[model samples]
Target: MSPAGASLGATVLCVLAWAGLAAGDRVYIHPFHLLVYSKSSCERLEKPTAEPAPHPSLTPAPIQARAPPVDEEALWGQLVPAAQKLEDGDQARVAAVGMLLNFLGARLHKTRAEMRGRPGAAVLSPTAVFGTLASFYLGALDPTASRLQAFLGVPGEGQSCTSRLDGHKVLAALQTAQGLLVARGRAGGRARLLLSTVLGLFTVPGLRLKQPFVQGLARFAPVTLPRALDLATDPDLAAEKINRFMEAATGWDLGSPVMGLDPDSTLLFDAYIHFQAQMKGFSLLAGLRDFWVDNATSVPVPMLSSTGTFQHWSDTHSNLSVTRVPLSDNAWLLLIQPHRASDLPQAEALAFQYDLPMWTKNLSPRAIRLTVPQLALRDSYDVQDLLAQAKLPTLLGAGANLGGISDRELRVGQVLNSILFELKADEEEPPTESARQPAGPETLDVTLNSPFLFAIYEQDSTAVHFMGRVTNPLRGV
Candidate 1:
């Protein structure tokens, strides 16, 4: 038989064997024996027996009683007023503000989890915390009033402070969850830091005392929302301000640039100066500004001096100048100074050389003396393309497939064989010179009806250099 035919036969036998195993314990009879039995006795094979079911009384019993349903409306009625009062009361009256905010945040998180298909939490936890804090600071809640009397089966003026206190408790839980999520990189860490800082400002009195320094530091905080949203959401602003204050107080700059300077570089002189100021309990803003000025004088090369020009001061002034050369789309070139005749010939032999794409001359030069014009970077994929790529099963399931495949059964060397067989028989070939050429790379689709069966043949082909199967030609087996 041909190789393909042999492969097909082998695949059929393997599949039948697999199917038999899948069917569980079963007797196999030879064709001759079956024929002899049929001829001697006109009786068919006996049917298999079924297992008996257990008695209802003997089965495991279910729980008898359940907890009573919570009265959500009554609970809400009790909680809302206290929450409002606590939010509207003076800061002095609401001493345990952190506990209150945290409680509300937790409740919000639980509400969010309950609403599985919803976009956000039923109660906006952050907003609730902000509102509660605002209410307390604004003096809406009075300490003399009975805030919990109406909700807990107690008869009074119907003001339930417990409800408001619950809101704060929920808020606290939500904040904890948020912290965990941010730490895991699920939520933005920077945003979380800012939020924490803002909350700290309200809870920590000493930080707010130095408002000007805090505000200055806040200016450098990452812009979470646009200017309009920033103004509308007071919590966001407060959070950013608090973040700035914390960073300043700790002598750490969260907004420091990541790429440019080496860790040991003198450019961090400003950071050192700020650290000294922080140690002495000086105002952060003034210290930072002074540090920058001092650093500019100390390390002139790294600092951008106010000379109305962008220039890097080198250690040695040579006749030859170093200029940046633009390479291709994603490359850069630095042209070193060419030595003069007075200098050693070795100096002209190129002080530094690095491998880069040879197509560096294609980029146009910018008019600025020492600056390169911004390159118009193009995205490799459009929105539709990105969405389609994201939806593909192959990329999503690659990890699972890798985990399941045994190295002994399937080696990387057999991948090419699998790919070749994976190509369908009816798949159109690449256009030749005689045929009308395709504008782009030709694409083909291969569908597998039974991928597991094909995988067995693929393993066989990898183990032994032979074509696997043609059991389902249309399915690319």
Candidate 2:
């Protein structure tokens, strides 16, 4: 698979893979707190009993293209993804999730730099993008589908001999990760992280989308809408409707990008993700700290400080310091800051050198004091540009078989992945002043007062679910 394809597949798998890691029991490597997905680590859940069907491929959906969105509401369908009753213990699962995490970390850094990784935050969901490609894969045929499979990694018993992947099974793993989050109901003991994902399909009026493609979409979003849109006459209006649907579904006033759909449009696709995790256990510092965007520029913002037995380490080689702190049972935050005040840009450049898992694996722990800005990332970007950066610009442009989206010679419309990641401390109740103090005699003092990169990752899968840099905490919401 091309690097772009592999990166895209890893992104798709991340949807569920990142979320599922929250429930499993895993050991934290001291200093770095990197969680290795071992058999012993997954004792909380049983091994998957049986593999899903092999080569559960979708049929050619050459339905039609030049239709219009007649019944928008009725067009939406309910998605009932098969409940994951069995947990597959195959090593392939680990390898698949691990591959996705590494890809995600690389993409995160790349995107961050592209967006100017300072004075603002950049966020994107890998699995959400991956989900779109999977949908396209279903709509594609022979060579197209096969090529997509290479990027999406493997499906079913990935280790077993199989010419193709079961798209449903691969998507199911992501749902498995999402399942871990909701398993804890809100009443007795449940998390407050509001993580939601939704997918939308817009077709020209009166097109018969394949049941197989629709069924495949159900694996990712419970409600997959097949709407009638007049791309030829009113493409912008159609885009508006799609945006409104996304905002309504997510209960956030997040309108989507105004896409330049072809006037002779057949199909368009969009994915929405809304995630916010308010810090519950940590105490907020009483005053705002100065965040340096550069040696000359600074911004004042609230900060969070803590001292505890976190796995902390400094790499003199990279001139970077990293500390891991638990955000939730399912989420761990890796706080990274440069060792020298002048090495911020150099540290950003070094991100390309370390596959996060490998770089983190080498970290050893010690008691430390860490202070971070009260940060949140509301980041969005065009995947097309990102694809171009990956050196496969026209892969989704012309002659692409996005048939699973619609039966006709579908044109790839605006494919956008938007992410909303916000962090808040002392949500339910105020933390005591003592809770804000360091819990141990600190060995290292790492203060993120300048341009620094950080990620909230699922330890088990090592998936960097949320990644961004805070150069000015006062910038992005």
Candidate 3:
């Protein structure tokens, strides 16, 4: 996959601040986290001719305070209030997470662009990838540590504890935002959301890992476990064991057997995420719809459709249309489809730009009839290869000082991220699902009939949680 540009080629160390810093019981988080503050693109979409222009954003009326039911320990959620309002800490975390999200979005885009029209869907998690890097940050030294701290959206650094942002706080904030989305329906007098992140460290037998690294990982994943592997004796067996262990740990097979463990290495790092959301007011079309894989190719797919007041924006200059389709109470699946099927790569590249937040501008509320293919993506990626594709090969490539991970000489091996993303109404019919939203021909129809890009973002933090593209809807996830 091709990279963004030469700027993206900057060494990971340049982003690191190793000045007079040492490994400690601290993690720094940059405070200014928001990536897009204003619109700076083709044009500020004006009013639509066919109907009254939709509101710039679907900002609901003021929400009153109330005693909301939510899992405080694991999730930050409340009733009555909408997600637009952000707290100081949450805002900072949003910016830090946003940067990582942009990077990951670019990675997803490159992968799909490299293999266009592949018979599978692609997905990635912003927080999960960031968490893995956080583990690295936990073991970093001085200038590098400081650079990571700032990159992660932690601002101000000094000898004083007051100046540094807590790494645990940043990780917790991301987890909370994720939980808030998946668990939103349950808190709002509906059903529970199914989402979780897991981090694992598989090391060669008898290897000792740093306590701070182990403990810091807890902030990112609910279940942070470190296990043993024998890559030297039998690399293939070791790979099989690791794969089975992950499957058992996450309750889902990785599909592909874990391969290519560096026998000389003593440690392997992995992160797993499972994010699934059932649309509240959606129903699958009675029969499969014809989705065009290309101008000459079409396939049948089970499409989900809904009708509601949604935020809509269109860019004629770029020849793209976007709509904020509600996935969960605290999250919106921002769907971007090109006016022309061949324009997908261009639209995807544009989406990767740092100013993507501007793309949501000038959108107003409109009654929309939305239909999209169900996305069930379960995939794993080698972090090393991913970094290379992102044009920062050496970020985790050669000369990576992962000294913090172990007390003895160790070769890093198989840094894989297992991501699972699924969306649907529900398996069993509730009979009332269809009636949840008014459906008719009067609404503006926004159907994803061809290749498109989509991202799920937390409304409050404005942080993109998941992103990917689908070319053939009929392809199994």
lDDT string, candidate 3, 1-477, tens digits: 234223242322333332112113225454332322223221333323677432221111111212122232242233212234456656565545554544444554465446445344667666667667666766665444554454443443343334444455556565655555655555344444566666667776667777666766765666666777567888887877776666665665456547887788666787877777777667777667789988998888878877788999888988998888766666777889999998887887777553354458767898887888876767666766665655545545435566555555456777778887777865443423332344665678788979988887766555677777777754534
TM-score result, candidate 1: 0.16
Clashes of 2: 28
How many clashing pairs in candidate 3?
Answer: 20
Please tell me which model should have the higher TM-score, number 1 or number 2. Answer: 2
Model 1 agreement with the true structure over 310-402: per-residue lDDT tens digits: 111121444333333221111122333222323312322222111011112233333222211111111011111211222322111122121
Candidate 2 lDDT, 197-303, residue by residue in tens? 66667666666666777787766665565566677887777667666655655555464654666676566666666666555555577766788887887888877
- In candidate 3, residue 43 scores what lDDT? 33
- Candidate order by TM-score, decreasing, is 3, 2, 1
Ranked candidates, highest lDDT first: 3, 2, 1
**TM-score of every prediction relative to native:** 0.16, 0.73, 0.74
**How accurate locally, in lDDT, is each candidate?**
0.21, 0.57, 0.61
